[model samples]
Target: MTETPFKISIPDEKIALLRQKLELTTFPDELEDSGWEYGVPLSDVQRLVARWANGYDWKKHESQLNSELPQFTRDIDAEGHGTLSIHYVHKKSEIAAALPLLFIHGWPGSFLEARKLLPLVTKGSDNFPAFHFVAMSIPGYGFSQSPRTKGFDLAQYAEVANKLMLALGYTEYVTQGGDWGFPITCRIAQIYGGKHSKAWHTNMPIGEAPKSTTEPSLTEKEKAGLERTSWFHRFGGGYLRQQSTQPQTLGYSLSDSPAGLLAWIYEKLVNWSDSYQWEDDEVLTWLSIYWFSRGGPTASLRIYFEAGNHSLGAAFSVPEPRPTIPLGLSQFPKDILVYPKNWTREMGNVVFDADHESGGHFAAYERPEYLADDLRKMFGKGGPAFGVVSGHSGYA
Candidate 1:
């Protein structure tokens, strides 16, 4: 595998085309009193579309992103999946002994999610630890190349990530992720635990309900968590069913219509978080990444299908074996599937856990400081997983 530095330079013609499409957009009618109960409000979409066409400066945000993230591309060889060109943000810490940390993003999110914590995790003080961070654009999302053939399941995503870290000399490293990231990083720990992959952390915890026969009884909080999970599956899971079962069928609309792409993702950004206020420009910038992604916006939705279905197709799930390495978790109250501490013990060798008073699905992006602090406490000098990675103590 070879790595080359990458820069964002979306062609001028693409920008012109986006403007033309925005100008010709035709909107639908909304109920007089309907707001979020129905979906993202029509007012919100109108404002965003106007800004995207006239006011939002893509070049300004594009340049800012390029300057903030030290981007790169590497061709990783995933077994049986052939060679894939991967894009990532690799920011090494000045702390010579900083630990290597791999950050992964989920659906509707890009490597841009890791932007805020890049500076926070680069140095440690007062018993807190620092790290050498590497956040990858999980293939088929962002700028990374998509899989050409089918049957690329959870294990393959893990393989690409593990190999990328090894290519960057990160034979041993810790990880942080949520959403789709939750499962992918877990796969990494299962595949490379006790050897190359060290401790892992996540904000989203998903699992089957604890049956009275096999698992322990659920507490009030755990019961509520189960209800939340159920709520997601009942109302919020329409996208999951489509993406997991027939992603290509829905891809046609997202790929052909830019407005359709915006609405498809913009809804998640609004509802998935804990009432985080989003500026129009901010929304447009995120939307732009998907609209201009390497294989188009729909490419990202297939992970749900591939992961849910077995390696062959009918059964849903690739292997999710428990890892025996030290594991840490950060519980955000408003996260989509918030689970109790006891429930997550089923994940792996549990070491440390933190419960936040606030925050939602996008913990790293919505509450970066809190997430970074939790990580420091988990791997600091007197921390449970401290010195988990050999030679990288994350100290000055």
Candidate 2:
């Protein structure tokens, strides 16, 4: 497999078409005083649509992304599913022995989530461990090619990630992820751990409720987390039900109308995060990626349907054998589905656990320093998974 350098270059015609679509967008009306009780407010959508049509410069943002990220694409052959051309940002640290770290993204997120994290983790320094980071656009997201066949579940996603790392000559590496990433990395650690995948970490660790007759004691924060999880299931999970059951049915709106796509994802960007202020341009750039994704915004939704159909069940509640590799969990209070410490411990060989006072689902993007610090602590000289990657100490 040949690794070819890649760049973001959306054609002028496509840009023109996007602009045209934004101009022609027909927005729906919201009920009076329905502020977020129903969905993304009409005013917010209007402001974003106006900026996207007239003010936001895709060229400038596109150029900046190209300049910042050292990207590449390679053909990875998934078992049973044929070869797929995967797009990834592979930044090797100046430290020769930097540990290789694979960062996977979930729905509504692309490799772009790793932008803030790249410099923090890969910079050579003696004070903290360094890493050779590989942030890939999971097949069917961003610039990566989507699977043609159906039933591309978590196992297939894990297979693609593992194959990409191996092809990059990372015989042994670690992983970090959240969202759908939480499950995908878990699957990777299960299938490839102890050999290619040495250790794993996640910001979103979903776990089952403790089966003890007596409920486990919960901290004030843990209690709040459960409340937040309840809130998500009650209010924020409409998209989940739709995506998991019938993604194609909703694809028409996401594919045809730029406004529909923006409102669909903009809700998550605002609600799933922990009050992280989003600039209009930043929000636009994030949304633009989905609009211009290689597999279209609809393709990204298939993981929901496929994973659910593969007996993973809704909410991925189905239990499986726990991976023995060292596992790290970084708990962000405002994350959509926050579970208690004891419940998460049941998932794997827990080595590192961090309970941050603030942040949310997009931890790497929202709190890169915290995420980076957690990894540094997990794999640093005196850390739990130190030297897990054999010769790489991740220090200068």
Candidate 3:
């Protein structure tokens, strides 16, 4: 597979059409005094829509991304599925012996999730391990080509990721991800571990509930985490059910109306995060990526449906034949499903675990330093997974 240098260049016509649609937007009515309790407030969407249409500068951000990220595209042959073009960011540490890491992103998130962690993890240092990282846009997300055939479930996703890393000369590597990234990487570790994938890490570690008449005694924080998890299943899971069951029905609105897409995703960005102070531009930029996505915003939703239909159960459920490779977990309180420490041990061989007092679903973006530090600790000298990939000490 040939690798090509890629750039973020949305055609002029697409930009013009987006502006036309935004200018012709019509807003819906909101209940009096309603706030996030109902959903993304009307006021928030109005301000974001207005800014996106008029004040936001797409060209500026476009140029900034192109300049900051070392992007590339390569055709990867997924088993049972024909060759598909994959878009990814590959940044190497100054130290040639730095470890190789593959960072994966999930729904409502693009390769943009790796934007913050790139610099932090790739900077070579004597005190901490450094890494040469690759963050690929899962097929049907960001600029990557979508799968044409159906039944492209978790295994297919893992196959594509592993193939991409192998094609890049990473015969042995480690991985870190959260959200959907957690499962996809877990699949990678299971299917390609020992021989190829040496270790794995995740910010969102999901585990099955303890099956006992007596509930596992929990710390105050763990008790609060269950309450938070309960709150999510009660109120915040409408999107999950919709996307997993009937994404196409919802896709029409998301694909056609920027406003509908904004409100739909904006709700998650607000609720899923730990009260991250989102600027109007930041929210708009995140939305614009979905609006201008290559496979269209709808393709990203199909993963939920495919995984739901093909897998054991919901995305949160642990997969079969769990990986025996070293696994690290960084627990963030605000994550949608925060299980007790004991619950996660059943997921894999646990070597490193760090519970952060703050942060949320988008751990790499929300708490880059925390996530990066965890990686360094997990793979640095004296760490459990150190020297897992021979000759990659990640030191100056």
Candidate 4:
């Protein structure tokens, strides 16, 4: 597979056209005192849309991303999907013995989620292990080419990830991800573990628990988690229903109107976090990555439809084989579905688990330092997954 250096350079015409779309955009009416109870407030979208069309400097942010991120493109041939030109952020650590770690992102998010953790993970330290980080723009997201044919499911996603690592000469490596990333890497651990996949970790480790008759009682924390899960099923799960069954139909609105797309993703960005302050510029930057992505924002939504095994009206869950690799979880209180710890343990051979008082769905984005530290401890000396990658011990 041939790999090439990649850069983020949106053409002048595309930038101009985005402004045109934003200028001609229309917004929806809002209920008074809505304040996130009724989706994203109209005022937030308006202010962001106006700034997105005006003061927010795409070129400035574009250049900063280009400079800060070391990105590349490579043709990864999935067994049946043919050759796919994949885009990825590849930052090799200064430590020669650093372990290779793949970072994956889910819906409404791109490889940009790994930006903050990049420096922290790759930084050489006296006490902790460093990582050679590789975060791919999962096929249909960011600058990567989306799958041309239908039925490109989790297995295919795992295939692309494993091939990318093998192409980079990492015969064995570990992984970290959340959201759609959670399942994709779990499939990797199931398929490639014991040999190539070594060990894996997630900030969003969720699973179907054992039958009550065979399971232990729930803790107060676990009961609280169930409450959060119920809340999600009521308020935050509409997008899943639509995305799983008819992403193509919904894609039209997201594709045509900048306002529609902004409100759609902006809600999750706010609701998913535990009161994390989101600057308008930061919001726009996150939105811009989708808006300015190669496959368009709509393409990213297809994963929700493709990655699942559920039929319409059935519960939105994709059941997979239990992964046997060493699993480490950094559970956060505000994550979308805070599954009881027992459920996640039933899903894999869990070695380490840590819970935080703060943070949520976007753990890497919302709390980078904490996630980095958890990863360090998990892969550090005497940690459960230490030396899983053979010679690369992540030390000086």
Candidate 2, 255-374: lDDT as tens digits: 999999999999999999989999999999999999998999989988888985733344354236778999998999999989999898888899999999999989999999999999
Q: Could you give candidate 1's per-residue lDDT for residues 1-396 as a string of tens digits?
A: 778999999999999999898899898999999887777788888888888989889999999999999999999987888888999999999887999999999888999789998889986775788899999999899999999889888889999999999999989999999988878888888888889999888877554444546666767767776776677767776787777778899999888777888888898887778789888888898999998889888799888778846221222212446688888888876677776666666666778878777888888888999999999999998999999999999998
Top candidate by lDDT: 2
TM-score computed on alpha carbons, candidate 3: 0.98
Candidate 1 Cα outliers beyond 4 Å, as residue runs: 212-224, 310-320
RMSD, every candidate, angstroms: 2.3, 1.3, 1.2, 1.8
Model 3, 1-396: lDDT tens digits are 999999999988998888888888899889999888889899988888888888899989999999999999999998888999999999988889999999999768999999999999999677899999999999999999999999898889999999999999999999999988988998889899999999999998887777876867889999999899999989998887788888899999999999999999888888999989988888888888898989999999999889847332555555667789999999999999898998987788999999999998899989899999999999998999899997888887
Q: Candidate 1, overall lDDT?
A: 0.84
| TM-score against truth, every candidate | 0.95, 0.98, 0.98, 0.96
Clashing pairs in 1: 308-316
Candidate 3 vs candidate 4, lDDT winner: 3
lDDT at position 289, candidate 4: 89
What clash pairs does model 2 have? none
Winner of 2 and 4 under lDDT: 2
The residue-level lDDT of candidate 4 at 144 comes to: 94
Instruction: Report lDDT per candidate.
Output: 0.84, 0.91, 0.90, 0.88
